[model samples]
Target: MQIEIKSLLKSCGVTSIMVTHDQEEALSMADRIVVLNKGRIEQIDTPDALYDAPASLFVNGFIGHANFLKGRTSPQPGTIALDAGCALALAGTAPPPAHRDVMVSIRPENLALVSDAQPRSIAVTIRVVMPLGAFSVIDCVTASGEAIKVSQSRAAWSGRPGDAAWLMIQDISKVHVFEATTASPSIARA
Candidate 1:
């Protein structure tokens, strides 16, 4: 039914406004998106831009599944000391916020599992593994007790709870940092 509606609009070359609460629906059907937070515009951009470079923490969480970790400014510029037990080296897309309290977010699929010896890796203990055929959703915890999630190929989901492992950010560009705000730490789950 959704596809039919979209097709009808497209076939007639009609410009239509769609108001939806379904993020996936909006993402798939719109050429551009305007995200609102509490009735205020948070960001206006193409879907790719909204997902890749969210203007703020709220936009980042609203657009997709994100792993939020508490982080802080390190002594070094552009470096964040994650409470998850590692330092995150950003891609230099933008300067780190001046505030000491910041949050780091990355999609689960963007995280890579590596040997515990890897540098800049976040130490986590495997909590649960949900196999989704081609891939698996892994729930884990940092030594400091922050919950983390990783998406990996099912064949590679071999770690048990006590197994030594670390998470590597595959592309620093995929990492988003924002000044920690009083806003809720997580998106409302359905």
Candidate 2:
């Protein structure tokens, strides 16, 4: 019905603007999306662009499920030292200013549960697990009380609540960095 309506509108040369709170609906229906935060425009882009390259923390969090870690940029390019003593190094994007406080944003699906602690891995305790048929949503908490969610195939993870695991970023290119301030700026767009 939605597709048929969109097609009919397009055939009639009619332009329409839809205001929806459903992220999936907006992503699927709109040609371009204007993400607003507190009535202020945060980003304006296509659905794919908005999802893949959000312009700010608000946009990133609004578009999809994201895990935010407080950190500061390292002296080395593309590295961020998390407050929890973990460090993240992005592979493809430009690094943020050294020593500048920043927040790292990564989608739940981008994180993987690993048995061994790797170079950029963070230790988290599995708090809850929700099995959703094909996949499971694992809720974890860092030692510092920071909560993170990881989505993976049901067969991939077998950890129960209270089990310790390492959270590893699957791809450095998928990381997003934003300034850790009220007037935050996006350092890594995509």
Top-lDDT structure, candidate number: 2
In model 1, the runs with Cα more than 4 Å from the true position are 97-99, 187-190
The candidate that wins on TM-score is 1
User: For model 2, what is the alpha-carbon lDDT of residue 71?
Assistant: 91
Off by over 4 Å in 2: 10-13, 183-190
Per-residue accuracy of model 2 over 1-190 as CA lDDT, tens digit each? 7798878888999889999888988887888989887788989999999988888777887886788888999899988888866888787777668989898888899999976788778999999999999999999998877889999999999999999999988888988988886643233222
What are the per-residue Cα lDDT tens digits for candidate 1 across 1-190? 7789889998999999888889999898888899988789999999899999888888898997899999898777788888888888787666465448988888998997775658788888888878888998988888888888899898876777666678988889889888887876575223
In candidate 2, position 85 carries an lDDT of 67
The whole-model lDDT of each prediction reads 0.83, 0.85
What residue pairs are clashing in model 1? none
The collision pairs in model 2 are none
Q: After superposition, how far is residue 65 of candidate 2 from its true place, in Å?
A: 1.1
- Candidate 2 at residue 37, lDDT? 79
